[model samples]
Target: MTYDLVVIGAGPAGMSAAIKAAKAGAHVAIIDENPVSGGKLLGQLYHEPDSGWWVGRNIAREMIAKASSLGVAIFRKMEIWGIFPKWNIMLNNGERLTTEHVLIATGAAEKAIPVEGWTKPGVMAIGAAQTLTNFHRVKPGKKVVIIGVDPLSLSVAQELKMAGVEVAGIYPPPATEVSSDKSNPKQIIQGLSAMAHLAPNALLKAAGKAANHPTIKNIAAKCYPSFGVKVWGIPLHLRKTITAIEGEKQVEQVRITAIDGNGNQKNGRTKTMGVDCVCISGGLYPLSELAEAAGCDFVYIEELGGHVPLHSPELETTKDGIYVAGNITGIEGAKVAMAQGELAGTAISSRLGLLQKGSDAISEAQVKVQDARANAVITFQQHIESGREKLAQCWHTNVQTSSGKG
Candidate 1:
């Protein structure tokens, strides 16, 4: 079927794009590999302190309903392997789809901290644990020891605790190339400053701000008690980390060791803690392989959470007629992704010459993306504005170079 737009990924961004474009007199179809729509929304559950609870599953259900009502086709459990010449989509199930416009919103992936026994049955990514508890309503473990101290792990640890699971505590990942400065207690404290705005209380917010300064933060980390501090009733161990997961078969225990504030492992100071499961979170990065396969150019911006395809602020990728929204461009919360989806949809519809009367919707949609970012409750990266400026510069440079070639 040749549709006006084919959105790849049923996550917030893709569904929202499908909804927007379909509303603009364009035939839109959305596809996802999961049997159910929602993507990461299937497991997200949290409170905004001011805005009340953010129930992703409920939001996704509402989006699906609205999109379906607008006559947007929805396909589930279909894996797309390639985007061929002339907008041809090759699905894993021997199906081909043709579309005039494509939006890549495949989202981000959890960067794993691969330590010993991490491949065990009970060890999983922090996101997997959230999915098990929130989405599937299943317990990941009785006593869970989480490795890595970040926003995602902290929230999931609280969730597990709320679900009656024993959260041993949040610990740092062992020092490794993959883990980077995340293994450093001091670095973690510094990085925590970026997440300060998301703290639920004023006291934590103050602490987060205080941690941003090098002198104050270093002194704090150096003086940090050997015993971890309890943040929201969950132990946050900045002075120690999980060095290795241990078990005869599955995950039964983990090796913990104290570290200096600078992140050097303290020798002769290792202990074992009994835990049924281990959740590692090395943070998140954009999953842009599909963007690459679609002939999009990419740039590695640390603030955007790794390699992201070069796209304009309008959400159009380097590849003509191909747009990218959400984490395929950068790792961010779902709200921003949805707004970008709207922007991309509006842009796509305008290109199809269907929005002649409502072309102003393009600018409005662009404002929405900015507003969403400014008001984002949880920001994964700091200096997002600067990161965006850098991305824009790259896009302009590429455009100029391409014009010169022509």
Candidate 2:
């Protein structure tokens, strides 16, 4: 069927854009590969610490409902394997639906870490762990050790804790040496104070309130490390390397060694940590392949987690009738993705002459979307910068090791 707009993926971006375009009197059609339309939002757990803003599924549901109200056509389980420069899309399910405008919202794929024994049954990526627990309702293991210390990994830890699994301490990769001369006393104090205010509430309510009780206060004071010059008031553990994982069919123990400044494992110094499963959280890479295929210009921005297409404030790509939104542009949260979706929809609507572009009608919608984008940029910058060095190190090591194996 010919349409005014054809949205691919049916995730937060595609669904939102479709609904907006349909409401504006455009004949919109959305195609999704999955049986459902909600995308990753449906598979994410509620209790993950940083996953508080997962409105994508809710937005998708609402968008679908609105689109149905507007008589937009939705094709579920339809996979588009190819896109032409003329905006003609090839679907695997033997259907050819052409549109005047196309919006690609196919999101990113998870990258796997290249380590020995990583292909074993018990080793999984953090996203896979989340999907297993949240969607499949299957616990990978009762005891789990998470590698990497970031909001995403921490969220997994919180989920596992709520699932009644024992979470071993998070292990960050070795940090570069801090220069003694450049250390600021005021900055250090501020950091410590922030951690002190934040740490107590990290625990369950009963555990947090028990610290005030006379008996538990003494125990908490003794067990918890003092807030000091450490990183986040928690000591940064330096390690040489994770040597090997040992078990028959499932993981049982992890081998680690202390490393020097150069990352060399100290000889004859090894330690073992017992855990049933290992989860690795490296970082996210932007999925911009489809945007690139649509003739959009891309710039390599390390802070945005790899190559991102150049898009206007209105979320329009270089292509005249094409738009992009959500994590496909950059690795931001679901809230920002939803807002970007709305922005793209409005811009597309204005471009098609279906909605008035500058009649003071779309100004409020534009402002809200721009504000969300600005805030997302600020919050993601810190994470993107801090994560770069570690991710680079891992990437180089993985490439070298994988090449040798090949």
- Top candidate by TM-score: 1
What pairs collide in candidate 2?
A: 240-258, 240-259
Per-residue lDDT of model 1, residues 1-406, tens digit only: 8899999999999989999999888999899999889889889998885788898999999999999999999989999999986699889998999986899999999888898889999999999999899989999999998988877887888889889999988888888876769988777877776667678555357557767677887787788778888877878888898888999899999999999888888998999999999998888989888889999889988888889999987888888889999888887888999999999989998888889755588889988989999888777776677888889999999999999999
Which stretches of model 1 miss by more than 4 angstroms? 201-203, 357-359
Report, for every candidate in turn, its global Cα lDDT versus the true structure. Answer: 0.87, 0.61
Model 2: CA > 4 A from native: 45-60, 173-241, 259-265, 357-363, 373-406
Please estimate how well model 2 matches the true structure, expressed as its whole-model Cα lDDT: 0.61
Best by lDDT: 1
Model 1, 214: alpha-carbon shift in Å?
A: 1.7
Q: Across residues 1-406, which tens digit of lDDT does each residue of candidate 2 receive? A: 6888888777777777788778888888888888877676755444223445443356556767887888878888887777776678778977787776888787666555555566677888887787677656678677776655444565566666666667665553332242211122211122222222224244323333553465654353233332211232232232334556677887887776564433444688878888788887666777777777777766666666677666655666657677777777777666566676777777777777888653353566667655765444113333343443444444456457757999
TM-score per candidate = 0.97, 0.73
